[model samples]
Target: MPILSRAALVEHLVRTRIAGDVATPRDNNLSHYRKLANGDRHYWLGLELGDRWTDEQDVLAVMAERCGVIDDPAHRTGQDTIDPELTVDGLERMAARLRKAAAGQERVLFATGHPGALIDVHSRVAAALRAQGCDIVRIPGGLVADEGYVVQFADVAVFERGASLWHTHSPEPMNAILDGLGEDGRPDLVIADHGWAGVLAQPVQDRVHGLRGVG
Candidate 1:
């Protein structure tokens, strides 16, 4: 499939509900922003925000610039927009990074906290990277974290507990994978989302790896 141009992609996003007016409720967005403002790590998505985003309004402003969400503090709860421009900007950044990875034949790890919704996305990227001569790093088996064993399905890393695979936001599974990697190797890039993002908040013990968490 040919890649869409910026304009075309923006239109496609709104047409497909991937951007413009999204399905996530305004109240939900505000709630998460409030939590992040309150120093809730769960809402931080694995980032060390520090004192930078303690105010909800400040958070909203940044979101508006980067995510296209409504910036008005008075606009509380109603329809919110995900600016297609910002969304496309993010897509472009991800594409550029992937291109670099492919050119370098870098090792990449694919993981997702939202398996039901994003597994296919991760799998497709992993396949493309593999085809481009990148190493699709394998998750070590028999490792456990978040009360579950880390596992892989469809070329993407995930968690399996209770004899079944499950979705998670915990970074423990990812940390386990890194620990299991030991001195053998580490991925140059880890593409992850949701709670798996939190792992980045904790320093990687001097291991230099890129974490791409697409919201």
Candidate 2:
């Protein structure tokens, strides 16, 4: 497939529900925002938020600024919006980081919670990085057993062209990956999203980069 021009990619993002009015319902975003404001650990996904986040309105403002969601607390239902400009900006930043990593041949790990939606993107990046002679770390056998349900590390593996994982919202997989990094080595950079990205950011704030919607 040919690479899309900037305009074409922007249009595709809107058409595919990856940008513009996102598929994530307004109610769901609001609920999650509320949980984030309340300092809910599950919603935080391991982020150590500051005291200023105690106000829900502040949280809404931040989300509005960063995610392009509706800022008005009164508007509670309908499709949530993610400004295409913000999406483009995010893409540009991610590209810059990837370029830097490639230049340095950085050891990297890529993972996602929204595997169904983002695995292709992550996998392609992984493949490109591998071609650049970057080390793509893969730690198998890390497992998270929560509430009688087990999430295997293999499920979240980001291989060259495909990822086996689907629908995971827990940070346990990332925690396991980090723990397994012990003496082997730590990834110089971690590209991830959702809970996986959020948790990665907590311990290695400087080295981890989080992508929205990919989680």
Cα RMSDs, all models: 3.1, 5.4
* lDDT (tens digit, per residue) of candidate 2 on 30-102: 8887888887877776576767588778888988999788888899899789887788888889889889989
Clashes in model 1: which pairs?
46-197, 46-198, 169-195
Minimum summed lDDT over a 10-residue window in model 1 is located at 206-215
- Identify the runs in model 1 with alpha carbons over 4 angstroms from their true place: 201-215
Worst 10 residues of 2 by lDDT: 154-163
Which residue pairs does candidate 2 place in steric collision? none
What tens digits encode model 1's per-residue C-alpha lDDT throughout 1-215?
A: 99788889999999998999999888889998999999987777656668989999888898898898988888877888899888888889999999998999988888888888898999999999999999998987898887778889988988888977787757678778878886557677878887665675456553243333312
Candidate 2: regions farther than 4 A off:
1-3, 142-166, 203-215
lDDT of 2 at 117: 70
Compared to the true structure, candidate 1 yields what TM-score?
Answer: 0.88
